[model samples]
Structures are given as structure tokens and as C-alpha cells.
Target: KKMIHAGAGVVDYDYRGEVGVVLFNHGTEDFEVAAGDRVAQLVLEQISMAPCVEVEALEDTARGAGGFGSTGVEATPAKRARAEAAAGGAAMGAASAAERTPHVAGEERAAAAGGAEVA
Candidate 1:
């Protein structure tokens, strides 16, 4: 099938005009609907009213704010880095060469590395 979808929308009780179904085709291939062919079907059902109750705020759940595979998305290298940063590691940005220590022995080691006497 190129594209066949079905959904329900609210129909008011006082409506008098005919309810039209909007069908669309947004696939790579073309979909043909010949005459007398079944293109779509509509299922009618009674919908009940759900009274809204007011309160300060809704209680939080275990899946609060998580959506669309947020719980399933694996931590990539970049994501891991970002999570580490968000967990207070962001302050440890790229260490500069001056701030890095490469196993320095002492003054003698520094002099030997520089090929000069330690004054």
C-alpha cells in the first residue's frame, strides 16, 4: 500500500452537513482507487465526556517528560560526554597544555628536558 491511514475526529452533535473523509497519498509510489473500490472505512462510536478536575499540579510519574524512545536511545560517545558534562563534569573542559602535567621528575628533569642548567 502506498499510504492508507485511518483516524477519528470529533463530530459535533448539531452538525448537518456531510462529513467528508480527507485521504492523502504521500508515498514513493502512486495509489489508485478505482470506482466502487474500497478506499476507506469509517467506524462510529459514542464518546463520553471526561470532566476536567482542577488541582495545583499533576503527580509526577516514572516516565516524566520522557518520550519517543527516550528510554530506549543508547548512549553514544557524544551523548555520554554530554551526560557527563550535565552531571557536573562540564567544568572540566579541554585541558590546556600549560595545565597538563606529564610525569615531571623535578628541577633536574625540567633542565634535562630543556637541555639547560637549573638556575
Candidate 2:
């Protein structure tokens, strides 16, 4: 059973202040935390920022500007199996680090992921 709802905490690089953690209790009973009690774990990771460039127009694609569920795909067992098969039995067609490519869209991307055709 889940008693607490803890989300990822992000501390900016240039913020000089006390780090605070927000914990949400999802249980009916009351929860208590004493001094020096371990409520969560923190891991420091380095992130990189890429330069942003302005473009006049974005590339045209079949699924252009389509967000989640824009392709009208249902998460069915049979469809999932087909998707897995198309991805060489890989889970969610996730590519290895070396084979990672930029976000693909439109028919090609869907076909590669074994997703349903987008209009």
C-alpha cells in the first residue's frame, strides 16, 4: 500500500536556500516524521543545456503538432503485441543509446513503433 506520494525534487544550480520537500499522505492514518528521519533520497546529477535557435517554419509531417492520443490509438493487448513485434520484440521500441535518434513523427515514426496509422 502507498502511504505517501513523493514526486521528484529539482534544485536549481544557482538557488542558495534551504531545500524543502513536500510529502503528500495518501492514507487515512496520520503520519509523523521526527528529526533526522529519512523521508526521501536525493541524488545529484549534472545536466546539459543546448542552445535554442529560432526557425521561420517547422518541418511538415503527417502528425504535425499532434500531442498524446492525437493518433487515436488504444492500449489493447493485441495492438501492444503487434507493436512489440514491429520493434524487434523490444519494449516500447526503445532504442539503445547508440541507436537513439531524434523524436520521429508521422507515418514513418508510427510504423517504426508499430503504432496505428495516423489518418
Candidate 3:
């Protein structure tokens, strides 16, 4: 499994030391690392710094106080239909399912093929 320290993946512009990656072995098998191996990738992302103001209280919403997994595990038929519509009604297979998901990148290209890489 891939593991990253908090804020460690993001290297500041002034950081000069050698970047290090940490990996943990949770399986029963032993993993080996050679002299040079492609384990992790560096993805440069533009950071946007915005000013923050603290509010006394947050406004109420329809789903207020509902935390993670509060909406239930299964998606409703209406939700599935919305997802399929968002994917241009291509959510008929595994590849299209990935395309319908919001977090997967290059979804259209993956849908054109057969499936998308899980991780």
C-alpha cells in the first residue's frame, strides 16, 4: 500500500534536502527495494493560498450534522441515474462506472478503452 506522511508529498519551493518516501509492509510477504526503483511519482500542483475568516456559527443546511457515511452505503436509483447522465449515459460497464466517478481522471479515455486503473 502507498503511504504518505502528512504534508510530506508537497515540497515547498525552498526545500533543498533529498525528498524521501516512506512505505510500510502490512502483508505477510517481504518486499525488496533495489538501488534504483520507480516507486513513487512527483506530481506538481499549483497551490492557491486564500485568506480565512472564522465565523461564529455555520449556517444550517438540509443535511446538517450528517457526517461521513451518514447517507448510507447504497446509492439510490436517482443518484445512479444522475451519475449515468453525468457520464453521458455510459455507465453500463466497469470502465463507464469509473468514468461516472468524480475522482477518476482521464475518465473519457478510459471509457473508450475497457477499464480504468484502480489505483
Candidate 4:
């Protein structure tokens, strides 16, 4: 399948008849999908039907009642900032680790070569 922009794409095996498109905006800017733009295509194959089961009442949980800023959208800004900071820190750590790896490898090679001078 092709991506309209750089978002996610999904395929549903349970859905039948007409196919549907599911896209998410993972970037900062909003994305649009135009009509007749070939969001997705599906080739019809063998069809099988199954009996559907319906649930009347289901069990509930304490957090089940929470939805849409129920925990306070005010906290979201701080949470996102902290998460971004953590991600940036992790990326930096990975870069530093990569930088040191070559040095460590060079040292090992030098020791292996009868203590020959590196560089």
C-alpha cells in the first residue's frame, strides 16, 4: 500500500463490502485525504461469513469513566514537555554511545595487534 503523506496505514481483515481508510496525523501539521485519491485498494477474494455475537452489558473499571481531558488537559502540556525532553536525552545518549563504540573498538584492535600504536 502507498502512504498519502507520512502517516500510518492499516488493513482490516474482518471488514467486508467497501474498504475503508484509516489515517492518523503523527506530525504537527494536519493532513488531508482528497476524494478519488486512491486512499486504498482491495482485490476481492473468497468470502466467508460468520455469526456475530453481541454484548449487552460489560464489566466496568474505575478509570473506565475517564475520557477526553478527564485527567486535566492542563497536565498534558507539562507531560508532553517532559516526554519530549526524555526522548531528546535518550537520542543524545545513543549518539554518545555510538561515538564511544569506535574508540573502544580501536583500543581493542590496538591491543590485539601486539600493542601497536593506533593512528
lDDT (0 to 1) per candidate: 0.53, 0.64, 0.60, 0.49
lDDT of 3 by residue, 1-119 (tens): 43322234578977999988776666667777787977677888887788999999999986689998876685643466456668777436555455445453554435433444432
lDDT of 2 at 51: 94
Give the winner by TM-score: 2
Estimate candidate 1's RMSD in Å: 16.5
Candidate 3: stretches off by over 4 Å: 1-16, 26-30, 73-78, 82-119
lDDT of model 1 at residue 23?
60
* 2 against 3, candidate with superior lDDT: 2
Q: How many clashing residue pairs are found in candidate 3?
A: 0
| Candidate number that wins on TM-score, 1 or 2 | 2
Top model number, lDDT? 2
Sort every candidate by TM-score, greatest first. Answer: 2, 3, 1, 4
Identify the runs in model 1 with alpha carbons over 4 angstroms from their true place.
Answer: 1-14, 25-38, 73-119
Tens digit per residue, CA lDDT, model 1, 35-97: 887766767778778898899988998678989886566553335445655786644433321
Worst 10 residues of 3 by lDDT: 110-119
What candidate 4 gets wrong by more than 4 Å, as runs, is 1-15, 41-119
Model 2's alpha-carbon lDDT is: 0.64
TM-score of each model, in listed order: 0.37, 0.57, 0.45, 0.23
Residue 20's lDDT within candidate 1 is 64
Q: Deviation in angstroms for 109 in model 3?
A: 33
